[model samples]
Each structure stands twice: as structure tokens, then as C-alpha cells.
Target chain A: MTVNATILSKPQVKNAGKLLAVLAAAALLFAAFLLANGADPLAIYSNMISSTLFTPYGIGEVLIKSTPLILIAVGTCISAKAGLVNVGGEGQFAIGALFSTAAGLSIGDSLPSFMGIVVMMLAGVFGGAIWSGVAGILKIRANMNETLTTLIMNYIAYQIVSYFVFNDLKDPDSFNWPQTAKIAHSLRLPRIAGKINLGILIALAAAVIVWLLVRKTKWGYSLRIVGGNANAALHAGINVEMVQIVAMLLSGALAGLAGAIEIAGVEERLRQTTGVNYGYLGFLAAWMAWNDPAVAVLTAAVIGFLSVSGNVLEISSGLPSSAISILMAIVLFAILWKGKGRKSE
Target chain B: MILESLLAGAVQSGTSVLLTVCGETVSERAGVINLGTEGCMAVGALFAYIVCAETGQPFLAIPVACIAGGLMGLLHAYFVISRKANQLATGLTLMFLGLGLTAFLGRNYVSVSTEGFTKLRIPFLADIPIIGDALFDQDPITYLSYLICAGMCLLLYKTRFGLILRATGEDENVVYAYGADPIRMRYLSVIMGGMLSALGGAQLSIAYTHTWIEGMTGSRGVIGVALVCIAAWNPAKAFIGAYIFGAAQALQMILQQQGLEISSFLLMMIPYVLVLIALFAASIKKNGKMPAELKKVFEAV
Candidate 1:
């Protein structure tokens, strides 16, 4: 007699179950870490929620931090959808900031405020696109690994900015601080609320645009095809290389836009350490969202909230801000682990 | 005289990279790739530094650092091998995890000094000529690196276990058919890679710089990763590649010493730029030799 013992469940349901389990595991792990560090997990978590969500200023800070993260995370989504990994977001962001700063410094006084802002944004986009395009072209033409190339490019970008800021762009009136001259007042982004600028709106709009493009456009269809199976896409007569390169350009442009927004909206002047962890944090956000652009927006907000809450934890519990990194790592490990397990089963 | 000094410096700087490359080469040979070398090195460096600082035992630090790194490797292996997660992403995540954990725990250890390894000149070899001083007169870790590199070469090329490891990387199914557990082999190699990377980190903190600093490994761990590819996954060639990068690093300092008027920032870009160029060169050949499993890492997305 033949026995049939297969269990029946919807794929989506199974996936949801797995995700919940992973998240619970991560929470437990984090609680253990908290206890080991001599802090009350319940109290610390409550403080994080109240400080980051209930307070008006805290909400504004969340929006401010989430702006760049949403932009970069969406950029990462685009690249991931094209079967490419663009770790160059860090470098691209730096280049974008550099170009925007340079443009603002050179021509901010000569143009109308709106025109100056547009010019700076355009310059920033072009700079980031060019920086990412280098790696994209190398990958397509030379078969070089984009992951390593993009990471190395980040260091190179930092050096370029450092060279200029230390020598040519030094703010003369700042008493030898390593920073560029402030952008003209007219060129700075207008604040919409307390510590909140129009960049958040731009980020939200970009997310919608990206979602629509990925869900509706023919280009998005081709990108998904390539990411799913390059060989099959090639057999289907899709120009795989072109799709990859264009996706990289678009991905890099978004990150560049984030850089521009951060500089114009927040810093107002280029500093050596601007947009420090946004690239990697955005990467984590995209990964958390499973490369879904729409989900990425929510994920970025959550990450940004946690980031700001890290400061609260630092002050209230005497925990270092870097502790948040361990939380992120645990979440990442759980997701990856669960995702792989479900796929194999 | 300048050339001799440059060569000597090249060897010194290359020691850490050499150790890391050898470690990565072994892991890749056994059908696993651990991109967490940087993270492992960072954590290892911190552990070694703290141990040395607290106990004043420089020798004990190396083993402690290895254990720390091995534990990290075991974690990575559990995810990549047992859980079957994507190796590249997991490696990157581990990198951030290491960076964050070390930064958090190492806050107090920064700027701390300890008893460190000193230069030991081989009596007969030290008097040979320009090459002698450059090669024979070095710290204990440097000599250990030389021994490790040679040992890896022999281990990879001359042993029955080595053949199985190579076969596992080339095709795990074949190894499984032969009744060898590919998963076990992968775990072993990856853990060893972590330990070796940690050893390199210990060398950096205890033998080279002698002081613990945050993110002190800088990008050398990443550089070591790239060197594996540039060397085509061969341990001997990895040794050569490390020294080549070392020479590039040494050249920059030499130029600065000669008052070349270049920005230090630009000089710092040399090794990274060379990595890009080397990657390009390595990729130029479509049929380039690499462990078959490693190639899948790039192509599999």
C-alpha cells in the first residue's frame, strides 16, 4: 500500500510563519544581550518606543534620518532586481555630495535659488551615476566582481573628498576645521517643519515612482527576468548587459539624490563625515524588505527609528550606540537563515 | 639602499595580507568562501590586544585571537553551510556584525598598548646581503607567516585530504559520491580560515603596530579578499600577490619620504586602485582558473 503523507499549506502562509519565528528568535537573542549588559530589556525598549515615536522632535529626527535611507534602499532594490549588487552606494553618495557642494559653491550666488538647487541636484545625480557606471561597465565588459569593486570604490571616493576638502575647499573662516564653505543661504533646502525638510517628501515620491516602475514598466519586467535567470533572459533575446548597466545607473542616481538631499537639507555644508552609515544601513533595509521597493520604505523608517533610539539607549541605559549594530546583525542573521531554510525545504 | 628598505617594508606590510590570503584560499578550496575576513580580523585584533593588555602575555594573545576568529567562522559556517544561506550577503552581514561588536566592546581598549613581538634576526641568514636583512630580520609573526604559507602550499598540493578538498570545491556532488561529507569539509576549512585571519589580526596588533586602535585593520582584510581572486586561488601565488600589494604600499611611503608633494589621501588610494586593476586583469580571461564553486558566488547573484 502506498502512503501519502504530504502536508498542504499555502506558500505565503509558510513564509509568514517562518518570518514570525525568525523575528521572535531575534528578539529573544537581543533580550539576552541586554540582560548580559546589565540593562532592563523591557524598560529600554519602552524608552525607545516613546522617544522615537511619541515625541514630535523624535518623529522629525526619524523622518530626517529615514529620508536618505529610503532613497538608498530603493536604489539597492533596483540593483538587486537586476541581479546586480551595488555596494557602491557609499562611494556614490560621497561623490554626489561632493558635486553638489562644488556646484553650490561655484554658482550659487549667480543663479536664482530654485535654479541653484536644480543645478546642484543635477550635478549630484551625474556624479553618482558616473561613479557607479564605472563599476557597472567593468562588470559588463571585464567581468569584474561588482561587490568588491564597489566596496573598494567607497574608499577611493572618501579619499577624493578628503583631498579636496583638506586643500581646495577648506572653509577659511572655520579655524582649520576640515570642511567646505557653507552653501549659499538661498541654495539650502527649505525646512518644512522642526528639523524636517522637503527631502522626506522627495523620498516618499521616489518610493512611489520606483514601485510603479518596477511593478508596471517593461524595463522592470526585463530586469526581473535577468535577475531570475540570465541564461533564460539571453535566450529570450533580452539585452541583459544593457539592462544591468541601466539599472546600476538608476540605482546610483537614487543614492546620489540621497546625498544631495542630505547636504542641501541637513548639513548645508560638506563635511568629511556626512552620510556616514546611510549606505550600509540602507543596504540592511533593502535586505530586510527582501528587495521589495514598497516594503523598503517601511523598513527604512523602522531602521531610522532604531538608529535614533540608539541615542536614547545610550543615555538612559549606558549602552553604547553601537549596540544597535548588534541588533541589526541579529535580525539580518535570522532573516537570511530563515529565508534559506524555507527555500531548501 | 632605498630598494632594500622598500623590499623589507614590503615584506613587513605583506605579512598580514599573506596570512589572510592563505586562510581564504583554504576555505575556497574546500568549497566555501568567507568574506568576513575583515570582520574576523577586527574582532581578532581586539581580542588579542585586550588579552595582551590584561595579562601581559603577547604569546597567549595569538591563540585567544584564533579562538575568537574560529568562533566567528563557526557562526558563518552554520549560516552558509547548514542553513544554506547566500554566502556573499552573509559574509557582508558578518562584517558589519564584527565591526559593530568590536567597536562596542573595544571602546575601552583603544589607544592601549601591551607587550608586543620584537624583531628576531636569524643569525646566519641575517648577514647574507641586501636580501638577507630584508628577509631574515623580521618579527616573530612574519616568520610564522612564511611557515604558514609554505605549509598551506604543501597541504593543498601534496595530501590525499587536499585532493578531496579541491574536488569538493570543484564539484560537491562528486565528493559526496565518494562518501566524503562536503558539508563537514566546508565547516572545517571555513573555521580554519577564520582562525588564520584572526592570526593575521593578532600579528597586526601585537607584532606590527603594538597598539590597539578601532578599525585598525583598515581595509587590509578586504584587500586580502581581493588578493585571493588576483592570485587565482593559489596559496603560493597569493603569497606573491600580497607582497606585490605590500610593495605598492611601501612605494607610496617612500614617495612621501622623498617629498613628492602628493597628497597623502591620493597616496592612500594606491593599494585600492591596484586591487581594481588586478581584478580587471584577472577578469580579462574568460576561462580564468578559479575554484568552480567560487565562480558561482559571482554568477549566482
Candidate 2:
């Protein structure tokens, strides 16, 4: 195999072994945390593993959760490659859901199922693009900190969604609950098996496409150059600002698609709480995978499993579901700790 | 009367953000952006609330909260300085760790109440006009916040230790050449930042809110980070910046009280939107030179 092809493959046996060792260390640390919290680590860990891996329904739920995570992570990779952090994925996702739902509501039963779904997805994409575009524009024009702007906007977007749900989007048939009416039946994604829909496939396909684009395209080359050193890219006659902005837009668009798919494929209605924390989780998944789309698929699944296990921890160990984040953070810390010397040197 | 109440309310609410901004200014000047300041604040608030609830002494919670926040800072320092992890990633993870850990540990303390610090109105100052009520007749923590800001300014600009700290942030190698330890300086600065941020959180819970609540800081730590940037990393400017945010929050409440019929959600966005506007204005005006290392961190994106 070519050197590039070999490099593109998974890590060698030794590296894989080291990764496993690191993961094992993280698991041990997490066990200590559970023990300190008065939970039986062995039982909790066993329950987490058995329930998530042993049941078909659990597997289906894992895939469903991973679907958005995969899509959002792929999008996160695009922005990370361009040397930007899109932590606003949460806000963008919320806005995307709002936009898609608005479009779905407007086009209710008027068009064929395929056409309606396409329109909704398109609306979602534009909605996310616009939401993230604000930060991108601020970065270029005002030189504002995108991280803070994006974070603040996440709250603003949530409030906006809440306002709509409580007012214009409130389900009239229901008793004043803050949620939009369910979309037309035809607008829902076709279920492939059990709780699984076509979303997983779509997410995987998007990941592959992103991987190819980032690896092979001219824009990808420019993105790498810009990310490496914007000054150097500017010296090379590249429009650094434009490239970064496009990356932001594309990243947000993908996140928006995740929001839309979530609405059609999972929630089937819009609520203020729809897709909560998915953005942050997806961003973490991308970071865990080091922003590589191919590796992101695996990382997304790992995050999804841990997230599902968080719910299990709540049920079995009587721990708050948020207890899972401690585990997640510890695992990430271990990874960062392990990868340290290599990057610094 | 409205203006008087508004200014007084601004001082009351601004204390927490002011403390955090000062802490962050010190940390960032030492060349590390602890995006986990939010986490530190959250952890601090919880620990402080716990201490206050258990002991019925809000003052005792301050030191405990500082220690708790310092531990978080040490963790971030270990990852960024010793392990050489990415600062942004480390900080974000620290934030999640803080949030999740607080939610986990604080679940039982949700409904607990404590005898928090009450405003200690200065006798002469209380009789003065609007400014006295705004500045002097306040909780001890709020008063301490003003001194902390001044002390931070002096520490960053007027002292030998401050010079070394600022020098370390600008160029670590240069400081190393001078026979100083940049690593230790960064750790100290970060820990100090964490302590101050925690103190802010303590003020929020034991003085302002008087009750333990999950996610109570409400991203105020982030606002602290933003204010630091807008202040151009100057502690003094951050004082003003914090009050501006506090006024925005105060305006929201004032408007709601007046029966203006605005949506609560829209009103809730005011402080955040004001941050965006302030950032825009600061960027346009070229407010101040960001610390050399801090600039690199931002440009690193």
C-alpha cells in the first residue's frame, strides 16, 4: 500500500493497545468516582455494559442517538479543520429544528412525502447556516470572539425556540403545552427497522462525503493551509476570511441537517428541549476523534453508548443522569493526558 | 427613583461578574485561557452553598469555595502545562466536568436553604445620596469585590510579582531567561483566577440568591471571560464592563416589574445580547492591546 493509504488506515497494533490501556485506566478512575459516590461500581458498570450491548432495543437507541452525533461531529470536523471552534452547534441545531418545523408546518399535506421532506431538510440547513453565519460574520467583520458569541447565541436560540413553542407553534389540539404540532405522517423518515430510521445511513453517508471532501478537494487544501497559519494562507493569495466563513457555514449546515433529521426521524415534533446537549456531545465526539470524520463515526457511537448508559446509571445506581458526564470528562482527560507528550514534542 | 434603584441594583448584581473578570484577567495575562471559569464558578457555588448550609456561616464558605476552585484550576494547569493538552479542549472538558459533577453532587442540596450574608449598610454611607446606596450599602462580599478589583490592578501593574507574571504571559522563554519559573507562575495565576471566580460564585449563592440551585451561575462565568476580553484584559475596565452587564440584567427585572408585557424569554436575552453588542463595540474601538499570549490563544482559534 501507498504510504498515504497506510497512514489513512487505523492505528498500528501497538498504538491500538496503548489506546485500550488508556481507556482501561479511564474506566478505573470512573469506577473510583462511583465508589466514592456510594454506588457499587462493579454492578453499575456491569449493568451499563449488559443493557446497552445485550438488548436489541438498546442497540437501536444507540444507533438513533449516534445518528445526530455523527452528523454534527462531521460538521464540527469541518470547522475544526479550518481552525475555528463551533461550540454554537447547540444553538444552530435548535434553530435548524425551528426552521424545519416551520417549513413542515407550512407545507403540511400539500406536497408529496419526498418533496416535503426535501424542503424541510433544506429549510433546516439554511436555518443552521444563518444561525452560525452570525458568528462567522462577527469573526470576520467585528473580530469578535466567536466562542463567546456562539455560546451566548445558544441561550438566545433556546429562548427563541421557547417563545415560538409557547405562542405560534403551540399545538392547538393539545392542552396548551409548549410544543409544535406533530408534522404530517408522510413527512416522517421511513423506519428501516425497530426504532431505527434512514437517519443512520444518512449520517454515515454524510460522514463519508465529508471525509472525501476534506481529504481530496481543493477547498480542503486551502482549509488546511488556513488552519495551519492564516497569515501564510493570505500570503499565498487565498481569501482567508472567505474560506473560514465558508467552513463555518458548511459546519452549521451539517448541524442543521442533524436537527432536521432528529425532528423527522426521532422527536417528530418541536419542543424547546428538543435536541438538548446534542451539540455539545457532538462537539466532544469530534474532539475525541481528533476531528477526523472516519474516526468520528466510532467516537460518536462511543459517546452515544455512554449517554445511553447515563440513563441506565440513573435507573440502577440511583445516580443523577449527569453523573455520566463525569465519566465522559474523565475519559477525555485520560485521552488528553495520554496524547500529551506526542503533540508537545 | 428608577435610576437610583437601577444603579444600586447594578452594583449588587455586578459583584459576581466583577470578581470572575478580575480572576480571568490574571489567568489570561499569564497566558492560559481557563474557559472552565464557568466550571470553577459552578463548583465554587455548590461547595460554598454546602458549607454555608452545614455551618450556617456564609463567611466560612468563602475559603472552602476558594480551595475547591483552586483544585479545578490545578487540574486544568496539569492538563495544559504538564500534560501539554490543548487549552481550549482542556477548559471545555473542565467546564463539563464542573457542571456534571455539581449536578451530581448538588442534586440533594437543590431545595436546601441557608442564612446567607446580609447587606451591611455603612452608617454614614447609608445616609448619603444615590451613589452611597449604590456603592456602600451592600453585602460584605460585594464590598470585597471592589477591593479585589483594585488589588488585582495593583498586583498586575504595580508590583514586581505582577511584572514577572505579565512578562511570563507575554513570553515564557524570556521569563525563563531571567531565571524565573514560568510554569509555576502560570499555575499560581490560574489557581488565583479559580479562587476569585469561586468567590464570585460564593457571592452569588450565599449573598445574592441565598439558596443552592443547580446551574445557578447561568453562564455568568462565561460573561466574565467575555468582559475580560472587552476590557482588554485590564482589571479596572472589567469593573465597568461588569456593571454594564449588571445594568442590563437589572433593566430586565425593572421592565418586568413595570408590567411592560414583554416576553420573559426576550427579556432574558438582554444581558447576553448586550455582551454581543459590547464585544462588537470593543472590537471596533480597539479597546486595548490583548496580552501577547492571550492574543495567540485567540488567533489559534
Candidate 3:
């Protein structure tokens, strides 16, 4: 086919076409992967849909999983908008859990149930903020690459948690398991339906607040300006460094809150596997939303559904849970490739 | 005697990271920052371990590992060079892809054993003092790494192609003006880097550890990338940085074995913490030595 014979289309139409094409390609690729592994693609796909969307308990699990993801994605959206890539969500989340657990263990018995939960969340926010602030300070003052530092910080965070669990936080009565004592029932988030809890509502509220913070405030405007062009923002008398630092802080606080919610809502105690892969999953969700707060919440829910389905696939078809990662990677690749096309245009 | 053994262990541990740093130096010199080095190593380790297990040929595993890693690099290059996608994002995505793919395919390989490369001693050199034993007596891959390091330095500083590669990193337009395709150079360098990184992973499994485990490379890939920066993109300096890091790792293991009061978890944090500190120090200095194109990748985000 001649290049000149190709039809030129409107930007919106072209974008829509690209999206559909990418989705089709990703679906086909995933099907091939499943087929290679001796599983029936059609059956797996239908099972995933039925189990995640059709069943009541499955739906509740989706909402439950989406809580931390939504919160973390909203946080990631803030940083992405500010042109800062925050990969330290895992570390921030872990620290938040650490602080929240400490706070819960101390005053949870004294306060009313709702108040205790609030106190734990607040503690989580503080913990996350401080953990992220380290990277922010390094970036702002030292001109260090936050991406690399944030990633390294994640390993450090894991070690810190491991240290605490193995020594300081290990439940005295527990039989050799490396976990902290379960939080008091008063500190736990109350379930609304099936296994779903108040954490989902909190995550939704966070999304709305972030949307407002980005759309309706002077600080948000300055952040956008800095993100768009640091030199231009500086010329316009904005404190670019301060904006970046604050954005990182806010981003980290959200991730921390995700960690807190996960503990209070599901696990009720900090364990080694607590917050496993949630940070990266949230990062993927934020990117899938193109860093839009409102869209991120929706994307988080979709990914959460898929993740739960991955579990079902493992049990039913013996497919590895890592299959979800392959799916996520394909989606990301397609979007990234499509984005490149848009930029050239 | 204790000091001599520690030094010997440090050299052994550093060999894998040293190879990766050498690879990263080449890629960065060609203006590509591959954050997916960790993922590449994971896939490489799995491939090498599996190949060694099945074929009982440790040497054959190296080429297989390189091919696996080279494919990953080609994917990264397609996005970063051909499509002009964001380098950092593409790297991160590739990392996830590598990890996911390896974990899925390597499920059956875990707990398997292999006939890994055994140590070889240089005749007179091995008989020398403490330093000789540490440096001259090593596995085949470790000896290969020393050659690779020296060869890399010579290739980068003393060759015409090396000049062109460096020019591509500093100014793609200059390379274009010189009638060379900068994009092609970038792709080649990135692929070469991937091959070297895969070799490092192969060494980790086939020469050092001798067993297959999922995610066995851990964050060594990342440490290698960081060491490239700490070395100021110099292959020779990367040698020192790699050894220092390896020494730290060896020290940690020694401390644990000695039953030091420090928590093992805290000890595990050493190399990562060092990377963070080194990165901060590097950043504090003005951006005098960083390739202009590489700076753009970090600044663009």
C-alpha cells in the first residue's frame, strides 16, 4: 500500500482507533500465551469475568483489592502530574503500616472504634509523608534522581519491616510466625457488604480530594506549571523546588494511607507479604489512567478485578498468578507505543 | 588468613556486578539508560540455569543467556530509539515484563541443580601472596570479566567506533552529520549491554551459586546500573566501585556468619543504602560528566 493512500483522520478518531487496536492486540497475545500453557483461553476469560463480576463475594473481593490500589494510584497521579515519578509507593506503604500498627497497638483500646481507625490512618499519613520526604529532600537539594533513590528505598523499607517483624513487632504468643499482633477490633475498618469495608469509601474520597486539589487550587496550578516547564515556572515566580517536594510528600502520604487501609481493612496485622506488589500495581493503574485522579480510581477497580481473576485462574487452570503481570505489561506496552505515535503527530 | 579469604570472597561476589556495570557503561555511553537491567538479569539467570541444568554445559549457557537478554534489549531499543517512547517508562515496563515472563516460565526450574563452572588457578600467579590468591584463582567467568573490563576500556577510549558511540550520546546530530546512523549505534550498544548483563546473570547462577531460583538475581542488576553512575560512566572506575560493593556484600555475609549482634535484615540493607548514598553524592556534583543525551532522559521526566 502507498503511504500517501492512507486516510488521514481526526485526532479523536485516530486515538480511539489506536486504543481499540491495542486492546485487540493485547487480548490476542494473552490468548496465545494461555494456549501455549495448555489452558483454554475462552474458558479462562469467561471464568475470570464470571468469577470477578458475576459473583457477590467475588465483587466484594474486587472492591476490597481496589481500595489500596485506588489510594496508591491517586497518590501516583499527583506525582506524575508534577513530572516526578514516584516508585517508592511500596516503601511509603510499608512505613505507613508500621506507624499505623504502632499507633493502633498503643491507643486502639482506649478510643472508640471509629476514632481509633481515624487515628491509625492519620498516623499512616504521617509515616508515609516522612518516608517520601527523604526522597523529596534528596531530589530538591541534592538534585538526585528520585526514581532510582525511591526504588532503593523500597528494598530498605522491606528490610526495616522484616527487622521489626522478626524482632520488635513479633507477637509474643504467636507460634514462630513472623507477624505482628492483630490490631484491636475497634481499630479495624468495619465491613459493609461481604468482605468489603469502609476502606473503599476512603479511597474514593481520596480520589475526589486529589481531583479537587489538582483542578481548583493555586498550588495545583503552580504544580502543573512546574511540571510542564520548570524554567517557565521559575520565571513566573513559582518556587519549583518547594512544589516538587510537596508533590512528593503528598504522593507518599497517599501510598501510606493505602498501606494503612490494607492493614485495617484486610490483614488486620502486618505480615511479610502485606502490600505485596500493590505499589507496582498502583503505579500501573495510575499510568493506565494517564495520571488522571478520577480515571485512576476506575482503572484501579478494573485491575483489581483482573488480579482476583488471576487468583481464580491459578486455582482452576493451574496458571501462575504471574499471568496477571504479563497482561499488565502488555497493556502498558501498547499504551506506551500508542503514546509515541501521538507525540510524533 | 581471614582478611585474605574476605578479599577472595569479595572478588568472587563482585564479578557478576562488574560485568553488568561494564554493559551499562556501554549503553549509557550510547545515551540509553536501561532501568530494566534487573529484569534482564532475572531472565538471563533463569535461562542460564535451565540451560546448564539440561545440557550439563555451563559454557553453552552463556550464549543462551545473552540471546535472552539481547532480545529484551532489542525490545527496549525499539521503543526508546525507534518509537521515541519515554526511556525510563519503557525500561520500567520491560523490567516488569522480564520478571513476569521469567517467573512464569521458570516455575519448574526452581530447586534444580547444575554442574556449574569450577575454579581455575593461574600457575605462578596463584602461588603469589594474599592478593594473588584473591585475584588469580577464580572461576572461568571471573577471568572472562577481567578481560571484558580491560577490553571495554580499550574499545571505548582507543577506537574509532567508540568515538562515534560517545558522539551519539553527546550529540546525535553530530553522529548524523558524520554520516553514521545514531539510531543504529544506539540499538547496537543497547543490545551489547544486554548481552553483557545476561553474562553477569549467568555467572551468578552457573559459576557462583550453582542453582536455579526465581528472581535469583535480585537487585544486583540495579546495583550494576547504579555503579555505572558512581563510576562516572568510566569502565575502569566501575571496577573499583563494583569491588567496593562486593566487599560490602562479603562483609555483610561475614558479619552474619560471625554472629554479630546486627540483624540479618539490617545487614541486607547495606548495598542498597550504599547505592543511595553514592547516587546522592554523584548528584551533588554538577552535571559536568554526564552525557548530554542521558541528562535529557532524567530531566525530561
Candidate 4:
């Protein structure tokens, strides 16, 4: 290989050991947790893999789970590049679903399918931005902390949606379960047979949009400058506050879109079951990718795979769904912990 | 008598969570964010409940629970202090890890009824009207919370020890130039925080509920973090923050009990909404009231 190609490929080679180490440590954690919990670790793990990928149905499950993760992780990576921590992705996702579900049900076939989809997506983006922009403005105007504000916003978002879902949005047909009425397919994301659908296309288009914005745009350049050195960017005549605000708004919009797509394409309703909290799982994905959007695509997919398989482990071992959460935490901690080992030198 | 009972509920939530708030207060005073306090409390609650149930003794449960909480704090120290990971993220992961581990270990202890300790209502004080019912009638831990808050105040403001801890937090590099170890100081503070956090959990299981549930601490841990802002780092004022928040929660249940004209859920949302306000205020403060020592401890995001 040419020296440049080899160098370009070295990040992959360099990354593999870290990934392996994390995976191995994670495996060890699972083994210990399972052995203590009285489940056969190997059997559960192998079963998880088979159940997640062994069939055509399994592929759809993986894609279904992977979709939200991709969107949220991408948003996280984008914001992280600008040095803004949008831990509110989940809230933004929830708000998107919240705004659209109310609107989607009301407008379920009052318009053309394409027009309805467009409206839903716009509502999702608007909902997400409005949710996140509060934190952004707090950061810009009040010097408020975004992380905690967004976190508190998450609780508020939860309460808001719960109010609607439990009270107003309750599907009259579902016996009091806190979920919305399903929309007509005309409002649903178009399908691509076997449950795979056009949401993936939206995700891909988002990735491309983010990549182009970051690599080829002046705003991306300024964001990097600001992220690296806020004082320096301020000195360089960049409107730091405006950049931070706009960045957060876009960041929230994209995440909101993920919630909208996930609801319209996969879940079809806002259930209290947290068919939506993969945003917590997505935090690790963005971190593992070091907040680089392109790499987050892969990170999101990997997490998606682990969780999908984790479901299988749940079935065979009678373990809780939270077993996967524990595993994700282990992996995330290891990544940060191991990364720290490097910095310690 | 009915008012007396409701007052006890307010005191129970307030005083019990005070351990967590105090523990976090001590941590934040050192400029280390112990967002993991919730997870620590959960773990502490699990251990406290399990031990109390198994041993049928309250005193023994407290120690076991505190020790469990301290160990988790030590893990936090390992990452946040030793390795210098992002305090917010590290603290958050600590919460996630604590939640999972506590739930995993708490499998056998769920909904298992156990005898809990009795209240130590003060004599003449308990018989007095409104204020008396609110303050004087509570468990021994409730009184201890007052002592702990006062003790923390004394520790933070009175002695040379407090100065070192404060200086260690305010400008550790400066503290370091003066030949003190900021790391050692922060580690000590974190452990203190861990122990108190455990006691906080002990109060939850051994003092009030007397049983453990999965994720039972709910948002109390996060609220403890917010209480720091509410308390503005004053131990005594923290009690006000804690009691007021606890009362906010108690009011929700009380309004429901009285069949008041508000949505029960809306009442429940009150403290959380207040937390959002507290967070906004913390962010926008003219940057002075925030302990100067924290800047010395955690430099940037």
C-alpha cells in the first residue's frame, strides 16, 4: 500500500485493539454477571447472536433498532465537534415524537401521504429545536450549563409526553395503555419490504448532509475553531454565541428527526415502554466515535447489533432487558477508562 | 393528627435525602461533581434494605449500606480524580453503573417486607402546633440530618481543615504550589461524600420505606445535585432546599389526598420544574457565588 494509504488505514488498525480490548472486557463482565446470576454465559451470548441475525426477520429487527441510534449518535457527534454536549438527544427525540404524534393523529388523512410525511418531519424538527434551543439560549444569554439544563429538560419532556400519552393521546382502542393512535400508512414512512423502510434513506441523507456541512462549510470551520479554542475563535471575529446557539438548534433538529422517523417508520406509537430511550445507548456510540459523525454511523450499527442480540440473551436466559444496558455501560466505561490510560502518560 | 402524619411524610423525604444533599454538597465544595450520588444512594438503599431485612437490625444496615456507597464513590474517585475523566460524564456513567448493579443484586430483596426503625419525636416539641408537627416529629435520622448539616457547616467554615479543603477546591494548582495534594484532598472529600451518600440511602430503606424497589431513589439523586444550587453550598440553607423540595413532593401526595383541584401528576411535576429553574440560575449566576474552589478542581468541560 502507498504510504498515504497505509497511514490513512492506520486509524482502523490502531482502532481495532481498543475495540477488541473493550469488547473483551465487556465479555468478561457479562461472563461474571451471568455466572453470578446463574445463567450459562456462553450459551446466552451465542444464542443472542443467532437470534439477532439468523433470519430475514432478524435483519429487520436489527435495522429497526439501529435506525434511532444512527440518527441520535450522528446528532451527538455533530454537537460534540462544536464542543456542545447535547445530552438532550433523548428529550429532543421524545419531543419530536410528542409533537408529531399529536399532529399526526389529528391530520391522519386530511392530506396527501407525502404531504403528511413532510408535515410530520417538519414538526419533528421544530419540536426538537425548540426543546434544545432553550438550553442553547441559556448558554448564550444566561451562561447557563447546557448539560444539566438539557437533562432537566429530559424530565420535563417526559412529564409533558406522559401527560398527553396517559391522558389525551391514549388510543381509545388499547384499554388505557399510554400510547397514541396509530396513523394511516399514508402518514407512516414508506416501507421497503420486510419492515426495512425509507427511514434508512433519511438517516443516510442526514449523514451526507452533516458530512458536507462539516467538511465543506465555513460554519464547520468556525465550529472547529470555537470548539478547540473559544477565546481564539472570539478573537478571530467569529460570533461564538451565535455559533453555539445555531449549532445546538441544528443538533436538536437532527435528533428530533430521528425520533420522528423511528416513530413513523418503526414503533408507530409512543409507548411508555421506552421503545425510545436508545438515546442513552447512543451516548456511548457518539463517544466511541470521538464525536466524529461518519464514524458514529458504524458505532451506532455496532451498538444496534449488541442490543438486538441482547434481546435474544434476554429470551434464552430470562435476564432483564437491562442486562444490555449493563453491558453498554461496561463498554462505555472501558472506552473512557482505557482512553484515560493513554492520557495519563 | 392528620396534619401530624403529613408533616412526618414531608420530614421523611426531606431529612432522608439531606444525607445525599450534604454528601453532594461536600463533593461539590471540592469542585468535583458527584452526579453519581443517585446511583450511590440506590446501591446504598439496596444494601441497606437487604441487610436490614436479613439481620432485622437498623443500626447494622446503615453501616453496610454506607460502605457499599463509599465503594462506588471510590470508583468515581478512580475515574474522576485519578484519571481526570470528564466529571459530568463520569458521574453520569457512575449513575448508570450503580443503577444496573443495584438492580442486579436487588433481585431477591424486592417487595420483601421488613421492620424499620421508629421515630424519635421530641417530647414538648412534638405537641406544639404547625411548626412543631413539621419539625419535632420525625425519625432519629431526621434529627441526625440537622446535626449532619450543622456539622458540615462547621467543617466547611470553622477549621483550618475546611480552609485547606476549600483552597484545594478553589485553586488546586495554587494549592499545589503551596505544597498540598489536591488529588488527596479531593479523594478524601469524595469518600466522605460516598459515606454520607450511603447513609442517605440507609435513611431511605431503614428509616422510611423499609423496603427497596428497583430505581427507588427516583430523581432524588439528581435533585440532590440541584439542591447544591438551591443551597448555594451552605449546609444549613441546604436543609431549606431539601425541606422545601421534600415538601413540594409531599404536597403533591397531600393535594391528591385532599382531592384538591390540581392534577396529581401536575403537582408531582412541581419540584422537577423548580429543578429546571435552579439549573438555569446556576448557569447564569454572575460566576461569583459558585465556590471559587471548584474552578481549581475541575478546569473545563
- In terms of lDDT, which candidate is strongest? 2
Q: Quick one: best DockQ, which candidate?
A: 2
RMSD of each: 3.8, 2.0, 3.8, 2.7
User: CA lDDT of each candidate?
Assistant: 0.87, 0.88, 0.86, 0.78
Better of 3 and 4 by DockQ: 3
Better DockQ candidate (2, 3): 2
Angstrom error of the Cα, residue A253, model 3: value is: 0.6
Tens digits of per-residue lDDT for model 3 on B248-290? 8888889988889999999888888888888877877753387
**Taking the tens digit of each residue's C-alpha lDDT, what string does model 4 give over B1-301?**
5666566667888876788889888888887878789889888888988887888987788778878988988988888877766776677788888888888778778878888677777999887877786787777767877888889999999987777788776777877898878888789889888888878877887788777888888778878877776677767677766776777788788878888877555677787787777666655664236667654332234
CAPRI grade of model 2: medium
Determine the backbone clash count of candidate 1.
Answer: 0
- Candidates 2 and 4 compared by lDDT, better number: 2
Clashes of each: 0, 0, 0, 3
lDDT of candidate 2 over A1-345, digit per residue (tens) = 698777555565556677789999999999998888898999999998889889988899899999999989999899888888888889999999999999998989899999999999999999999988999999989887787788888888988999889888889987988899999999998999998999999999999999988889999999988888888999999999999999999999999999999998899899989998888888878877878899899999998998888788889998878888898898888887876322310
Model 2, A340: alpha-carbon shift in Å? 6.2
Model 2 Cα lDDT, one tens digit per residue, B102-152: 988999899888887998998997778878888888899998998999999
lDDT by residue (A1-345, candidate 3, tens digit) is 554444454665677788889877887899999999899999988888898899998999999999999999999888877878888888999999988988888885899998999999999999999888999999888877788788888888888988888899899988989999999988889988878999999999999999999989999999888877789999999999999999999999999998889889899999877997788778878876777899899989977987888888887788787777888788778877876344310
In TM-score terms, which candidate is top? 2
Residue pairs with colliding backbones in model 3 are none
Q: What TM-score does each prediction get for chain A alone?
A: 0.90, 0.93, 0.92, 0.93
lDDT of 4 by residue, A33-81 (tens): 8899899998887777777788887778888788888888888766676
